[model samples]
Structure formats: structure tokens, C-alpha cells
Target: MDEYDFLGDVAVAGSVDSFDRAITPFLSQAFHAKSLLAIHFHRTRLPKVLFRWIPDKTLRQLFDKRYEKLGFMVDPFFHRAFLVQDWEACLLRDIAPDRFESSEYFTNYFGDTNMVDELGFVARIDNDTAVHLSMGRNQGQRRFRTNDVVRFGQFAKILAPKLRQILINQPADDVVEAQPLDRRFHAMAQARHTNISIREAEVAALIVQGHSSRAIGLKLGISGLTVKVHRRTLYKKLSISSQNELFGLLVNYVGADA
Candidate 1:
């Protein structure tokens, strides 16, 4: 009957490693299971541990002998799995006669799975990355129960927003190509001379979306203080202070067609 809430901690875990450590104790408490494992990624190569449930005595031996020794390239799948763009990529494949398995990923990473039955959400972290989570009960009486699955599913939802932030809210890397603005956001920035960086434009659009500094920070994988700084800079660049004044200042540029 543990009643601890892992929602806040998981959100604060940020990166994969941090998330792994943060969720360990929480998972232990919530699921009351013997073992757990969490794999996180940042592209197609950097598959790092987010957390794990290793009950074996020789953890090193298990990793070295099983994954590396077997030559299974788990890293590729871990790093490349993104939910939004690759919704059709996640699948389930049993490794041992309906025992252990994974949520198989698609060429692009998003997809469905036969691994566990539960509710979940997927989101794009960037143009090339995403993440996913699903919860299910172990039918075996000695292992887990339906209540455990229900509890974990609730916990997982708490992390969804944070996961979205981690995967999607990152500051735009100059290396990645900027996404073409959608009609609304595009119209808002129509007169930015088409030379503004995507990061700047995204911030501008968020501002128009009526997102507060703190809200934008959570959505974009940045600190609220950083959002404030960006807002100030944006004001200076656009020659306005109040968001109320923004539409008027940029109306000439964005509303020109109208």
C-alpha cells in the first residue's frame, strides 16, 4: 500500500540517466516487482541507462554475456525510438516463448506493441527523436497484478508531459534543419525576413500562444529564468515589451496579407 507519487521526480529526472535513477526506487515501491529496466536514447547511437531492475548477482556478467556476447544491437533501437513520427514502428517480439520481449520499433520508431496492454502517449522530441511508455499487469500471481499495472499506468501519465518536454522542448540545435512554420505560426512570423532561427521563431510563436514564461520553459526543455531572458531579448529585437503590444508591432509584418 505504498502511496508515494513518482510523477514529479520523473519529470525532474530530465535526461535518460537521471530518469533511470529517479524512477528506480519509485518503481520498486509502486510495482513491488523483483526487477525493472529502463532504456533511454538520444538519436541512433547513444542508448544510455535511464534505470533498471537487475536482480542477478553478477550484473556485469549479465550485460556482457547476454547483450554484448549475443551481439544484439539494443542500442540502435533504444536511441532511435520516437513516438510521434514513428507511431507505426513500435511492435512486440517475444524473446523466450512468450516470456521476455520488447516493444519493437519501426523504421522511423513510432508504432504499436504486443508487449503490454495499457494506455500511453507518444510525442516527438525533435525532428529525429521521440519516446514511449506503456504499462501492464503480470498475470502471474507471484509476479504482478492488475492493480500494479493500473498504478504504473497512472504514474507513467504523470511523466508524459515531462517526456514531451525532454523530447520536444529542447533548444533548437543549429545542426538540425528548421521546420517550416505551420500556417498560424508562420503567419505570426511572416515578416521575420525569413532569416530568423527556428528557436527564435518558436519562442515568438509560443509567446503568441499565450504561454507564460514558466509554461514555455516546461514545454521547451529550458529553465523559466532562461525563458524570461529570451522574452526580454525578443522584446528588444521586436521593439516591444508587453505581449499585448506584440500583435500591434508585428501586425504590419504578419497581417500584411489581410
Candidate 2:
């Protein structure tokens, strides 16, 4: 199908619910991607998924059930979409932080996906919102090459502008208005004991997302020792002894919200 037909189907689908059936299959074949996930980002509220397709059942289940709630915080592609402020296809390994493969988030949540690589399109609608078109290579598929990324980038020059306009005109569901993650994170942690501070809650959020103490410190602009102190304190406050327990608590928290 041509670009217009592809986008026409997307627009006619109305809301994001139909996106999987409308655009995912076409894009997958066009890009030779094993999985595709289209997400609409809200600057403050939770993002809305426009479309999702994964060939692997276990990986798809993990993405739907846990990624948005926990693993997303550590996702470089997701974070970069906000920072890039432009349309481009980005490779995951090129942008991933040092020691990322060794991090708990990757070892646990991300590792479970069995995906070999990812390339994402950041379609910035404005300062407040953006749409992400992410395509991935699963374990058995070949990795995206430099030339392929270049082609995708060239394609973005066409795809992004059209998509931005389509999104503006079609206007999928409004982004939910809600408190920032840190505040809400703190509130949830305090359900058992209201001793978690806002900063500690921030630390907890990153921790659950699979950041190491050192990485968390770097991102938060503090020393490794400070991160350790905060980690210890929050662990005591939440009555959790290990990262596994903390993850379980947050998983339950997200499930409750659902």
C-alpha cells in the first residue's frame, strides 16, 4: 500500500484501539520488523499505546503487563523521544547508557523480551506531546543495519510530517491529566508507611525501572553514596528487602490501578 492508503487507514480507525489491525501489519512487512509498538507520549500523564504487535507471546505479555508500569522508566528510546525534539530513527544500542546490559532492568524486564535490537521513530507533535513508532528485531531476526537505519531516517522525513498532521487532525483520545510520577510514586509507597520522601520516591521509581545505584545517582545528579543511602532508607520505609520485593510491590500497585 502507498503512504496515503496506510495513513488513511490509520485515520479511519479513529482511536488507538484499532491501530494494531490498521497499521501494524503493513509497517512490519515494510520494515522487516518482528514487532511494532506505536505510543503517544504525554509530557506529564501516562502515555497511550496506539498500536502494538509482537510475534512472541511471552514477550508481548511482558510488554503489555509490565513495561509501561516499570520497565519504561529505564527505556532509553522512550526517554530520548522527549529529549530529541525531532523526527529520526534511533538505534537502541547506540543510545543506551553504559552498563545498561548489566542493569537489573535489562536483566529482568527487558531481558525477558528476547528482542535482539530496536529502532524507534520520535515524532514530536509539540513540546507537550509526541508519537513514537518503535520497530524491533526479535531474537531470531537479523539486527537492523546502519544502511537500514539510514533508510528509516530518510523515510522519517516523509512519515513524521504526515503523521504529525494526521495526529493533530484525527486527535486520538486526550492525554490524561494526573500528578507527576514522583509524587504519585511517593504516595503509593507511603500507603504502608508515610515515611518516603519525594526524592526517595524518585529513587524508588528509577530503581524499579532497573537503574543501578550508580546509574540512578548519575541521572539524579547525586553521588553514588547518596543513592545508596536513599536506597537503604526507602527499602526500610517500604519494608522491602530486595529489588525483587520492590518490583513485586510496584507490580501489585499497577495491577491495583488496572
Candidate 3:
């Protein structure tokens, strides 16, 4: 079928599941992506994996075991996409931090994925929720060109309204609520270390949440230097040196708590 026919069908899809099934085939064909993931973000809660279409068994297993569990915490694209309030699409590289490729998150989780590139669509569904649709190309494949990003943007404009409708019709209870970050960290820090201070724990929590030192300072009403000081102290107390290590520790703590 042509793009017009497929989009028309998607527009009239009766359910989110049906819309997803219809669109996945079209997207896979258009982008040459072997894996697709749709993640729903809720306010102050763990993001839900709304849908995943991965053809390779090994890749699926790795995603479920690692990426689904901990990698999201450190994903620059995941964090940046959610922060976006508008409906838009972009390549992961476009949204990633300047030094993202050299970061530990890249070295630890993303590097192992063997995926050459990722493109994402970010759509805000409500006041406190949004969804991100990611397309990944397998290793050794040529990266998406400029034209691909443009085409994906057009597709996103068509998909966003339909997805918003589907998500709006779901029961409110479908979204799980998580405990406050500070409370969770307080308990975890107490159980893990005796030398870490409350301020240091707060810094660590923000770091794991994907906030830069400047952002953390703004949120806490402190100077950037103070935030850095807290971060350095926290790193020393945790015996970790990089944000990647801090992310690993938080993920492990959260996983253990679960």
C-alpha cells in the first residue's frame, strides 16, 4: 500500500493496539529499521514500554534484560525527548549532548547494542505524559540521511493526533505511580552507605535523573558551583567518578528495590 492509504487507515484505527500494528509495518518498510520501541512517560513514574517490535531474538533479549531495565536511565535521547513539549521528530544524535558518544552510558549500554543509529518521534499526550517512538538500524548499516529525518518528521505529524486519541481513551489507572525520588533515595542510601549526606544524595538523585549540574542548581535554588561541589562530594562518597557510574548505582538500587 502507498503512504496515503496506510496513514488513512491509521487515522481511523479503533484501538491503540491496532494503530500500532498497522503503523509498525509501514515504519519498518520506510525506515529500514529492524527494531521499534514505543515508550510512554508518566509524571514522576517509571516510563512504560507501550510497544516493541524487534525481529531478532538476541537483540530483543538484550533490550529486555538491560535497556529496558537500566539503560533508559542514562539515555540522553530518552531524557531530551521527554523534555520537549512539542510534537517533533529528530535523530538521536541531534538531541544527544556534545560529549554523549564518549560518555559511559554510551560505552556501557548503547555501544553493546550494535545499533548504528536511532531516530525518534516525541509527542506530548497530556499535561504530564508523553510518548517516544524510536527506530533503530542494526550495526554496519549506513546512518539515516537528512532526507530520512525529514520523512520521519512528516510521519510524526500524522501519527501524533491518532496516538493522543488512543492514549486519552485509556483508563487513568493504567498508568502506574511511583514513589517520590527523594524518599526512594533516602532509603537506598541508608541501606548502602553511611557516609553520604542528604545533600549529596539529592545531587546523586538529580544526576541519575539526567539533570546537568546547571539544571540541578536551578531546581535547587543554588549556584552552579555549589551544585558541582555537591556532585563532587557525592561522587567521592559513592566512590564513583562519572555520571555513568552514578546512573549504574541508581539503576541497581532501583532494580533491587523492585
- Whole-model lDDT values for every prediction: 0.45, 0.74, 0.76
User: Clashes per prediction?
Assistant: 18, 0, 0
Cα-based lDDT at residue 52, candidate 1: 50
The best candidate by TM-score is 3
RMSD of 3: 2.9
Give per-model CA RMSD. Answer: 18.7, 3.7, 2.9
For residue 153, give model 2's deviation from the true position in Å.
Answer: 1.4
Q: Model 2: per-residue lDDT, tens digit, 25-129?
A: 777887798888877776776777776887779989988877666456567766677787677678888777765666566777656888888887887888888
For model 2, the superposed segments whose C-alpha errors exceed 4 Å read 1-27, 67-74, 172-174
Question: Model 2 reaches what TM-score against the true structure?
Answer: 0.79
For residues 109-182, what per-residue lDDT tens digits would candidate 3 score against the true structure?
Answer: 56677777899787887667887888999887889999999898888887876777787887755545565455
Runs of candidate 3 with Cα error greater than 4 angstroms are 179-186, 195-199, 205-227, 242-244
